[model samples]
Target: MSNRPITPLLDKVCCPADLKGLSDDQLKQVAHELRQEVVSAVSETGGHLGAGLGVVELTVALHAVFDTPRDKLIWDVSHQCYPHKILTGRRDRIRTLRQEGGLSGFCKRSESEYDAFGAGHSSTSISAALGYAVARDLGTAPEAGVGDAIAVIGDGSLSAGMAYEALNHAGHLGKRLIVILNDNEMSIAPPVGAMSRYLNRLYAGAPFQEFKSIAKGAIRHLPEPFQEGAKRAKDLVKQVTVGGTLFEELGFSYVGPVDGHDLDQLLAILRTVKTRATGPMLIHAITKKGKGYAPAETAPDCGHGVSKFDVATGVQKKAPANAPSYTKVFAEALIREARADRKVVAVTAAMPDGTGLNLFAERFPERIFDVGIAEQHAVTFSAGLAAGGQKPFCAIYSTFLQRGYDQIVHDVAIQRLPVRFAIDRAGLVGADGATHAGAFDTSFLANLPGMVVMAAADEAELVHMVATAVAHDEGPIAFRYPRGEGVGVELPEKGVPLEIGKGRIIQEGKRVALLSFGTRLKEVREAAQALSAEGIEPTIADARFAKPLDEDLILGLAREHEALITIEEGAIGGFGSHVAQLLAERGVFDHGLRFRSMVLPDTFIDHASAEAMYAEARLNAADIEAKVRDVLSGATAQAARRA
Candidate 1:
C-alpha cells in the first residue's frame, strides 16, 4: 500500500462518465496515470501485465468517446481489461485481482455491469458484440435501447477461426457494430500464422502509408464540394494496396491502421464512426504489447504474463521450486522419447512455451508445429500427421482443448488415429479462475469411445505417462497433468512405460479404501496418515487410467473394503463418474458398502490459491480424513447393531 502510485488525473476518474469533460491533454495525462496504476496494481498481484499496459490509451479513448454500459464494450479474451476495470468503478478492488473473493483477472459479466460479456476464452467477442448490436436494433424505443456494440479484439485472438466466423456473420447481418482490432503484435507467445504476417504488412512502411497520410490530410483542406470526391479517391487508393480491403469485402466499413496510443487519432476516428456508421465497422489500431515500462517493452513475450515484481527493478519474486513443474517433466520425457523414436512430433495451438513445447521446439525444431490459436486445426493436423505414420503429440491446455472437441471426435477418435494428447493445466489452475480450470477435460475425453485417458499422480508419474503415450499406438491416448511444481518426488533417469489400464496399490490396510487419481494422490496419502493416527489404517490405491478403469484392481478394492472413497482433481463426471459406473456394472454396490466420491463442486470455484480452492471444494486432506472417519464410524455402528 505504501508503494501505491500517485495518480492525480486518474484520481478524478471514478468512472467512465467522469472522463466526459476532460480536455484531450488531460485525457492523455489520465492515460499515463492509468498505465502506471495498472503496472503498480499488477506488480503486487501477478497476472497479465503487458496486454493491459498496451491498451491503456485505447481504453481511455474508448470510454471517453463511447457511451459504455449503455453502449456495450466487449473485450476479446479480456486479459487486457485491467485498465478498463480501473476506469469502470472497479478501481477500489483492482489490487485484489485474481485473489479469492476478489476481482477476477478477466472480464466477468457477473462481476460488473460495465463488462458487457464475460470472456476468458478468446475470439468470442465479435460474435457477442454482434448479438448486442442485433439486440439494440430489435428494441422498440431509445429508452429501452442499447447505444452501440463495440468489440476490442487483439491480433492474436483474430487468428482463431471463430473470429472469422463472427466477422462473416456480422458482415451478412450488416448490423451497426464496431470492432477494434487491437494489433499488439504479441499474444501469450509471439503471434503466429499468415494473419499475423498480413497485419505486419499493413503497418510495415509501404507506399500505402505515405499515400494514406497525404490523402487524409489533403481531404480536410479540400473545398466542401471536392471533399466527397477526395474521400472516394482515398478509398480507391487504399484498395490499390491489400491492407483493409479484406475487411471491406466482409461488409465492414474499415477505418484504420491508426496509432492506438495517439489519443487524438483514436478519439477522432471513434467520434466519426459513432455518429455516422450504420453497418459493422472495424478500427485496426496498431500498438505495442508492454508499451510503457522499459523492462516490459524489451523483454521477450513483451512480459505478457508476469509474477509479482518490483516496480523499480522489474525483477519478479518467484517462490523457489521444490520440484520440476509437471510441464517441464513432460517436455523432457517427450524429448527423451523423440530422441529414441524419430516419428515423435509436437503440435501446439499458440502455446508452445506455456505447454513446455518450447523445449521440444528447441531440440526438434522441424518436428514441432504451432497452429496459432486454432485448436481445431491443431487437433486435425496432428490426426493428419498420425495418418501419415508420424507419431504426433498435440500438446494443449485442458481448458483450451474444449474448443477442438468436435475435431477430436470426428478426426482423431472416429478414425482411431494414434495422436497423443499432452494435456497441461489438467485441473483447478490457480489465479486464472474457473474459466481456465481443466475440470471438464477428463469428463469429456473419457466419454469418447476408443479414447484412452490417463492422469499423472505427480511429476514422476507424469514422466511415465508421457512415456506411456509415446509407447501406445493402438488409438488416441491422452495424459493429464496439472499446473505448477510436483510434490518433490525423485524422478526416474528416464521414464519406463507402464502397462495400460493397471493401477498400483500404495499400501494394503483394512475397512475403508481410498482410490486416488491424478495429483490428488499426495493428499490421499496425507489423509491415510491421519486415518492411521486414528487406528483406521485405510487402504490406498492410485487409479492411473480413468477410461479403462483398472477393472480387477477396482473390483478387488470394492470386495476387500467395507467403505470406498474415490478422489480426483477434476469435476464430478470425470474419474469418480467412471469408477461409480464400473462399481454399479460389476454389481459391487449390491452388497451393503458405504461409498463416497470426492471431486470439484458443481459450482465454479473462483480464483484462489490451489490449496484454498481444494479446501473450498472439500477435497483437501483434512476433508478426506473427515470423510473416512465418518464412513468408519457409520460402519462400526452398523456392525454393533448386527452383532
Candidate 2:
C-alpha cells in the first residue's frame, strides 16, 4: 500500500473546477487514489462496488479531458459514479455514501454542479445528453456555458430500445454530442442481444492501432479520384465487418474498440475523438467488471453489489438467522408451479439472480429469458409469450418496471393478456436509495384497467400470490414483495391460488379497524398489539388486491369501526391512495367517518439499512402506533365534546 495518503488531494476537490488546475500526471495519480478510496469507502458502506471500480479510469479520463460543470457528462445508470463523486468535491462525506442524510450512491444534479444530469435507471444517458445538446443549440441558457454533451453508457444498457431510439435521433439531428460505450461484457450480468454479439466480434478483431496505421498510410498516397474511391471501398469493408458500422449508419462517427483500462490508450483515443470527430461520435472502450479485485473478478456474479465484507477475506458479515429472502420464496414457488405446468416460463431484464430466477434458469435454461436491462422489451416480450399460449412471469424489480409502464399499459393491459408480473423489491430499497426504490409500481399498475395488482403480506403470502398469478389467466396479474427475508414463516410444499378481489381478516376487534396491505402487516400487527395493551382493541384485515379494492370488506370495515386506517409500503398513488379513492367514490366518507392513510412520505428517502430507512419514513411500528393513538385521541375528544 502506498504510505502517502490521498486525503489532501481528494479534500481540495470541491467540484470539477478544482480538477482543471491539476496536471495529467496528477490526474492519473488521483485516479489510482480515487479507486483506493472507492474500495475503502465501499468496504464500509457496501454499494455497487464492481461498477464504481470498473469506471475508475474512465471517470479520470473524462474529467481530465472535458471541462465538467460546463461540459455535461451524463453517466448511464449512474451506479459507476463513485470515482466521479470522489473527484468532485464530495470526498469528505464519501463514507456517508448511501446512508440516511448522506451522499447518494448514484449521480445527483442537486448534489453538485459536476453531476450534469441525475440517473438511476440504465439507458437514459443518451436521451438526457441529447436533450442537453438540443438545449445548447436552442440557447436554453446562454450564460450557463454548456460546452458539450457527453453520455457514458454501458454495453448492457445498449440492449434497450430507448438507447437505440436516442442514438437514431442524435444521428439524424446531427447534434454535437459524444457517447462513450463502456463495453464491459456485463451489465449487472453478461450483456445480451445482437448489439452485444456484434461488439464481441469487433473485440475479437486485430487491435485499433494496427488498423488505423494501415488505413492512414493507404489513404495518404492515393490520387484524388482513387482516394475518394478507396474511401468508399474502406467504408464498404467497415460496413461488412465492423459492428460499429450500425452506429455510423445511424449518423454517428464511430471510433475505437479501445482498451478501457489502459490509461494512455484511453486518453489518446479520447483526445482524438474530442477534437477530430464532428457531429455525434461513439467511442467504444472495452473494460472488465470488478477489474482490480481478485475475489470480485472470480465471483460468479462479478461482485456487482455486495454486503459489508472483510477487505482481506471478501467474506460478508453473517446475519443472526438463516431465512430465505422474499425473492427466493417467490422463485421456489414459481419453480414448483413451472414443474407442474409446461406453459410456465420466466423472464428478466438482465437480472436473473437479483430477481431470483437463477434457480429456474439453471433448471430450465431454454425457458428463461434474460433481456438485458430493457424493461420495456421484457414486458412486451412477456406479453408475446402470453399470446403464444405460454404462461410468462415477468420478474422485474418495482423500480425498473417504471421504465416499462407504457408497454405494460399498451401491450398487456390493452389486450388483457395473462402476463404474470412477479414484481420484486416492491418498497423502499435500502443502500441503492431513492432511484431504485420500488415505490410507484403498485400505484401505477393498480390504475390500469383490467390489471390485477396484489401485494404479499408475508413470505407465505408471497408463495400463495405466485400461485394466484399463475392460475389467473383472465388478464395481466402482478404480485409485489419487499426486499430481504420473509418473517421466518414456515415453507409451504406448494401454493394454492386465492379468490380474486377478496381480503382476509387476520385479527378481530371492535372500535377501530386497520386495513393493511403488503409488508406493512407486521407493523400494523405490532401497532395493534401495543393498542391492545392500551384497551383500544383493533380489527386487522389484509387487503390483497389493490385494483379490486375488496369493496365488501372495506365497506363493512368502514361501517363497523369508528375509524379505518389503510397502510401500504408504497408512495402517494399506491394501495393507500386506491383505498381512499374507492371509499370516497362509494360515499364511505359521507358519514364523516374518521380515516387515515399510512404511506411513505412524499420526499425521497436516502439509502440505509431497510429497517432504518423504514423508520425514517415513519412506516415502522412506533410510527403506526403514534398515528393510531393520535386518531383515537381525536375521536375521543370529539365524542366527549358532543356529549
Which residue pairs does candidate 2 place in steric collision? 14-89
Q: If scored against the real structure, what TM-score would every candidate get? A: 0.96, 0.92
Query: Which digits, one per residue and each the tens of the lDDT, describe model 2 over residues 47-166?
Result: 788888888889888887888878899999998998998878788788888887789988998898888889988889999999999999899855877888999999999988889999
Candidate 2 weakest lDDT stretch, 10 residues: 221-230
Cα lDDT computed for each candidate against the true fold: 0.88, 0.84
Deviation of model 2 at 193, angstroms: 1.2
- The most accurate candidate by TM-score is 1
Query: What is candidate 1's lDDT per residue for 352-380, written digit by digit as tens?
Result: 98999999999999999998999999999
lDDT of 1 at 192: 90
